[model samples]
Target: MSEEPSARGEVLIVTGMSGAGRTTAANALEDHGWYVVDNLPPQMLRPLLELAGRVGSELPRVAAVVDVRGGDLLAELPATAQQLRDANNLRILFLDASDDALVRRFEQVRRPHPLQSAGTILDGIREERRQLQSIREGSDIVVDTTGLNIHQLASRTAELFEEEGAPRHRTTILSFGFKYGLPADADLVADMRFLPNPFWRDDLRALTGESEAVSNYVLAQEGATEFLDAYVQAVTPIIEGYQRENKSHSTIAIGCTGGKHRSVAMSLALAALLERIPGLRVRVRHRDLGRE
Candidate 1:
């Protein structure tokens, strides 16, 4: 069946091991524009998703944190997710870290474990891990944050939901050598260095891809058509797979030897190609595009 216009928004179910940064991630998702609900019961998941779908269409994004705190009812989550899928698109992200990290976080916070009320932190960690194994395995994305600080985690989370500029939902960052031109970061990367160097194209020299003249000159190249054909072939399937999985964001990087000219042109082209995908968000950045 054709996907409903993405239902106008998304529901992200956030769960994972204790002390694995679910709270932090939820906060970051909120910063990136997601409306968040924390520590809701698993039994209420179906009803909540339905309500969110009814209301979230106006909000654009929603996230919830579910974990062992649900007590015995936590086991019912997987089934609840399956049931919700018939009416709404859902993505589950399970966050995890090393046992040592979990223990360290607990000690740092000096809070009693919900499951460890009767035992050591180690015991609590083990039980939580055992109980969560199934959910973790079923997760669409598993983020291991053992070494990531709050900033790094926030950056990663923001990358998933940021909706401006290049393709926001599914981006590919491709790196390549200038001599070989741009790598297949998207469906196409046009090399403009061989063109009447925009850097030397009269009044247009200082303009980057953001300008109409530079864009026109790059698109006017003979190789542009050939590259676009090959690019679309290579990029179409990757994006299709991401869409099938209901991904919210992707980053594809295109790199040339100096990160200028060719890579920039191709990156812009790839961003354009991605725009054709329904509801797919795209974003592009040329890491070395301005470097001398």
Candidate 2:
């Protein structure tokens, strides 16, 4: 899945909670052929994009790490990002984590959180979360790193930005389990529990949704095909609207009791249907497939 890089420069704003693996993400992007700039001020984003545009494919994909390190200047990022979106391919990837995870990381490193000052690390995290609320909302993707190690985070980052020459409207169909909690980054969600569970079938219990037997069982259900057809129909217009609005990415989460069977099968089926929509790039991922 590769093609010539787009002529127009693509810019990614890498931000979010400090110590949430921003540096690791930047390293992964760099290793995978993205030009990465770290600790970049918010105001420099426009100029950087302009430079990439001038250089064309030589600088086709560039990622900038922008965060609270800029102090008061970080306030201008949203407006600057909006201004760059009209003529450029821009996306924001926010890396976030739970307060406890952040505190642990800070303590392990024997360093104070940037905003901690004389207060506790938790205090700094609370303040940072409040300050970043708006930017996080506007971000195209929010990766919660609460349960991920550096290696896992790096792999996840690669899964997202490594693909080359993606369509104008790209979507990730993620299959997850309800018990593990919902994905923080889901733009839309679909529940698959209404259909029969493949886990109940004695023969299918050992197999995953990737197997033909389970996929057939799930898709052969009474309303499965109809639901897939209608859901794809319902989502087409939204993808078009994203194109019109210069938003390049979206995520649709499909869930069931555990993510191993029904949700995975349905997510694959849905991706197959969506692939026919022309100009839309579809990728499927089972988030909780092997979890216990």
TM per candidate: 0.54, 0.55
What local distance difference test score does each model get?
A: 0.71, 0.88
lDDT for each residue of candidate 2 in 79-159, tens digit (9 for 90 to 100): 888877776788999999999999999999999899989999999999999888889999999999999988778768876
How many clashing residue pairs, candidate 1? Answer: 26
The clash count for each model shown is: 26, 0
Regions of candidate 1 where Cα sits further than 4 Å from its true position: 1-6, 164-292
Residue pairs in steric clash, candidate 2?
none
Off by over 4 Å in 2: 1-7, 165-292
Index of the highest-lDDT prediction: 2
Pairing residues by index, what is the TM-score of model 1? 0.54
Q: Write the per-residue lDDT of candidate 1 for residues 1-292, one digit (tens) a residue.
A: 4333335467789999888888878987875568899988877766665566567556767788999988988898888777666667688999999989999999999997778878999889999889988888888889999998876676677666555653324565443446545454344343434444456567766666556676677678777757667776787787766544435455565654455555576667767876787656666666665655
